[model samples]
Target: MLNSLLRISQKTALTLVFGLFSGLASAQATTYYFSNSGNDSNKGTSISAPKKSLAAATALAKAGNKLLFKRGDAWYIPFGLFDLSNKSGTRNNPVIIDAYGAGDKPVISNLNVLSDDGWENIIGTTTWKHAIYGYSKALRLFANGVSKYKVNTSDKLANETDVDQPHEWFIKEGVINKNGIVYMNTGSSLVAPKNVEVLMVGSKPVVLMENTNYFTFRNIDFRGGSTSNIVNIWAPSANITFDSCIIQQGAGSGIQAGHSGQGDLTTYVANINILNCLVDKVWSDYENDPNILLSGDGIFMLHAVEGGLVQGNKILNWGHSGISITSYILGVHGVHNLIVEMNDVSGGESAYTHAIDMNGFEGLTTHNIIRRNYFHDYTVTGHILGSYNQIYSNIFAGVTVTKMPRHSHQGWGVDWAVWRYRGTGPWIEAHHNYLVNNTFVSTEECAIMIQDSKANPIAVSNNVIANNIIYNFGDIAIDVNTNVAGTVIVQHNNFWQENSTEPVARFKNLGTKDVYNAAELNLVLPQYFRGNTQFNPRFTDVAKRNFTLTESSPTALKYGGTTQYTSLLGEDFVDYFGKKWDPFKPSMGAIQYNGGD
Candidate 1:
């Protein structure tokens, strides 16, 4: 009798435990579908009976639930707003928004259209403004889905000091009245609204993520907006991801991750990953570039964010820079421990822009890694690095067809590399950075140019540059503009020929002597120059486009342990020879003699 009672109790306890587990698992997860034909009145539990509006379906979402929009559908949210409030998802099970029933990707855009009645006839073609869109952020002017030209003006103008430059439209309140005006200079002396259709973005984002965490968006085509980027993250959210999506037609910018306040690094935005997405046309015709800062950027991440990765995105045709890893910390600020890799950023060759610009003007942005990216046709600075930044294993190429008219002698053709700044730092004036093992196939200028910009700039010491290949530089291999009084460690690199008759290094700025002048160029001279070899790396075949060094190449041979730049990035990592190579005999450049990536 006792044994029977004990066995019955044990079976009951096990059954209760399994029931609790099952209930928790079921409650924590669900799959919700959405279609235009469906009604919001349904429970949206199955694909057959789905919800109609994304906003209504989003309201019912919980953590770990999946919300899939019907493919081949378009949902124009009112006021371009898809607001999220007070929701959180863990890294293990994030709230997902993706597409279903594969065909064309589902699209979410703004529904508000600009009426021709709001635009009035203007007398002088200098400026045109219409306040149809909420008069904040930036705006764009488009005709038949193609970007049109704006009038160029050089006056004290409205808010931006970077005035006199070209803009498609300029929006300002009280310009004509309190309603705000949209300035349009279509290049004609007396401009009138033509037969072209026009669309304007109001002051709201198409997708706004606010005070939320761990939301994943995938396989969606986000389009249109007269105000700002398609998506905007306004809080210190974590694990926010966007993958396999198309972000197009941004008025101000493509995407902005975080904002700066109080210069506090503690309340940072973290763990944001933007991967495998297509971000295009982040161009603004009109912007409040007040003081000449803040314009259209494809992807802009700011503030001190730890643990982030930006990889495998094709960002193109931005009005300003493509990737702006920048901050606006009122006082000293920071951003560290991030990986930006495997991206193709191109076609952003505006006269006043660069491919990637990490603006550390507010504070120190350190320990960021940029590698394995392809940059083409960016006429200005290809890449600019601040202190504690690493630039390695990338290709910067400029094609002949896309080459602008800016490559004349004494112009900005050579672009720049490892361009340093000095507000304050630990390593001399500007230090703690590394440029290693990259390939530059430039057609206009030298391989690398170090510019301080101002007259008699201060020290740039304790930085390391090693094992890189620079080809097709027009004039000189290395050109230092302002005098750099600090130490810069340059080691075993290859500077190949472009114009054939060009010299190797052009120091001492002006009429330039052949010698490396320390005092004149404000450099410490040979003390900063360490074991950098200027020779042909001798690739297998230049015509066949085989860039790997041949066995007969001098750079293919052994480099000793004493020549290793182990102190640079705090790692004894592998380069051309891979990680398993004998440490004492490391080869030069990014491409190993064995031709491995």
Candidate 2:
């Protein structure tokens, strides 16, 4: 909180006090508690007379209010919450809804799990179909808290089954049915798993922030939505946050931070902070459309949601990408000036999907920071697409995807691309972008890939990739395909290898111009060579993941005592180990050196 305060300007502080804390200064704060055992008619002032429903607590909630749900209590389908709007508290005393007196985190689910597995077997086949209360739109089925691929009626699941054959599902009429027999092998038969749950689509979110502001939700477990987000931030509000909450298992995206109302981008959502939240297991119900884009995701920051901090979130498996910060607009008012840091984005379930994808389809998405993240095991950890963004101080461990069979191209540890909006040229110039001081270890294809989308012809220029450390094993370390006419800066990066290999090679797909890392200068001087060196940045240990360099490393002052990198990588920053940074005397890669710092 103090760090945040220190970053705010004097004018911004006054606006926060007046706009966010107006309610706190005018009225005394109140505390309300809710529990499963309490009644709706209770005063809800004390724990004994706490309110029963979330509706009652929200109805009475106001600024400077603390709404605490009893731990181990749950608010199920029949009593789902209404949207919270029009009410807000000040920054000093924001309205907080949190868990109290815990057995477990308070659960707020929109669907009931089907515990009774009274499945009727088919006449001849080994298939089974169970009756369910069906609803309109797509239906999502989950077993063991994971999304089951909805099977098509025409696809055969019999001879095409594998060793660990997937349990594909298809809905028939108002029932859930499985295709083919449950035979895993010639002799053994597979039984239907008991932990089956279905969710309906098209409903209000479990916790809807419709035109709401200045509120904080803490330590609450939100799950089980029906084609709706566990939490949705609707249009035209700010100072809203979700902190330290368990946000998971929704039929749709975990958190939807936008509202496509009337197409006004100037009056967009801003100052939103999603801090230290656990967003996991969110599945988009695409039974209706499997080819749907921008659906299942951990956190979808859409429609011009800008200027916020998305920090310390552990996101896992919500397909289209773990975290997608985008806007689907064309003209102006782009989503920019955001900080996405300290998040652990891992494990992609969908093909050709990345851990994070920030596309500026809406407007010129620029000036955002993607730093200090630990990405691993994902099909593509991040930035299959982005522009004018700063990506630095992040670790890429066990990066996957030797080649993108989907895109008919090879994948890399870091990718940057920009697409024009509706074929309109110059959406956002991919200029002034930076990828610096990052570490990529044990990568399959390459370390960094910088490309200019065909639609974005020449705007993808003036980007910088510097001071990086790569343990790239295959192909090239930096493969830049400048299909357009501008140049990208590459310099001062250290490449480590076990065996003899040309790690200093710079392969490019530039039409007529050739670019290479100058050996004498030790920088990738586009179109010519100045200088380069095979500088071994003697590390303490590499096998145990200790990337701290030895005191007598030669790569110190590798940039030649130049502070030019301060603009690209951001100054006064800490390294991977959270040690303080000295911009002038900087070390390469994510972590700062005690001696090197």
Candidate 3:
């Protein structure tokens, strides 16, 4: 009887240990936390009970776990990696890692891991040590041994240390001691230090999704530091949505899809919706390094099987183009509905590039609608290189295309073209686009310049350009120079307050020119410039120099038109001082002047 009782007790103890181990193994969901003052085993559930690092929580978290961070707690992660590669979760049950507690607004501060010595090394080698050029390069070369050096076209120097093998170094200190000791004092002499600048190194992408599906990242903030992309959704990540997040300060693009190499290409990014997000301040380390070229874009949708919707987002301040769509080099075409609407894009000119760019080859960018957005204050062209596209209802202000001598090259202005490949294809319809009532203020050259020089058989027809208010422009409002074999129409456009001394409409060898061309060709310019009046447009308060049209002004009901104008003169217009103004009727210009009190 005693022996039997002891056996039962040992079996019960073994059973309890087995249960605990099983629970640890199948921990499918759990809550974790992070705090600077916390240890690795501190429950990791809340602010008071937090984990020491994000890595510690992520390692143990399963598919349906929540890695909640403490609010207002700043962490310094030098080179952290949150690998969600092997984890698979449903859309309803996603792995949520977010800031928690205190109204759930976590401020994840970006950690600057590099020291001053490292920064000095990067600046010296890249010739970015000083704001001005040439002088910085010369100083770097002299410090690194000019006798073994060679200068490149961009004034960057290269040299060999012991043998003829190429080596580069920057001056960390201006002076050096005879004992070969390195100090922070001035006049430090030449020697390649063991510590190099922490250049962001990985091209593997910060958030890489491979052979994964049904994923969603919401309300997360991805701050920048490393050289890798913020998010890389390869062919495997189909049916993904990134909503209401801030993806900023990435060394590469904010979001990049598709691989660059030629392979089996089994993975294809499709059904992706990036909505209500802010993708801004995406720059490249190559911008500082003269040896490398900046190739990626802010949102690169390449070779997608079913194109997606990119809406309600502000994509600004990028190193390269804002948005780019293209086909693979192996002639694999992908299409079906790409809708880019209601986006506010600006400041895409780091090296004189575009804000929104699309390059489609033999694939269709068809049924794509780019409408109702505000693109302004851009140093380069706002839009470029698209086909079968509908571009309408957009307000373009302060768009400078001309390359001023001191700023950029002059030939790099915005030219709306079908493709850069010069492939002979038919021109698509650019019609009913309320290029009207939108403002084009302080533009360097043509507001709407169209070029169809590629002997492509495409025609530009049924396009309506009417009642647009243009002011302080440097060149013609509409300039079409195309070899298109079809009849292109331009009618009922209001070219108001143009600063160009040239003709408003310049067409090359097209028979069906009307309106102003009609008198020259013995036909009427098909539209009316009637009660649609233009003056200083009577901005309210002369001291403020506001441009909002008042109610009793001539622009009120004076806009005589049968077709409904999409934009009123000042539809949701605001002054520089953030004052709101509305016009009485559809005002004739881009800005509706509200009359003074």
TM-score of each: 0.72, 0.81, 0.65
- Tens-digit per-residue lDDT, 313-360, candidate 3: 777766556766655344444433566655667665344446666545
Candidate 1 per-residue lDDT over residues 291-396, each given as its tens digit: 2433467887766555577777888777566787765453433566677766777755343445676645423566777765665566556444556777765666
lDDT for position 102 in model 2: 53
Off by over 4 Å in 1: 1-28, 111-145, 148-201, 260-266, 282-294, 331-333, 348-352, 361-363, 399-429, 453-458, 498-502, 509-528, 538-546, 550-563, 566-584, 595-597
lDDT of 2 by residue, 490-568 (tens): 6666665653335444445543335333352243343432222345666667566566667766654233222456764
- Superposed on all Cα atoms, model 2 deviates from the true structure by an RMSD in Å of 6.0
Tell me the deviation in Å of residue 135 in model 2.
Answer: 3.4
User: Candidate 1, which ten residues in sequence have the lowest lDDT sum?
Assistant: 9-18
Is 1 or 2 the stronger prediction by TM-score?
A: 2
Score candidate 1 by TM-score against the native.
Answer: 0.72
List CA RMSD, all candidates.
Answer: 12.2, 6.0, 14.7
Q: Going through the candidates in order, what is the number of backbone clashes in each? A: 20, 14, 35
Provide the clash count, candidate 1.
20
User: Weakest 10 consecutive residues, lDDT, candidate 2?
Assistant: 6-15
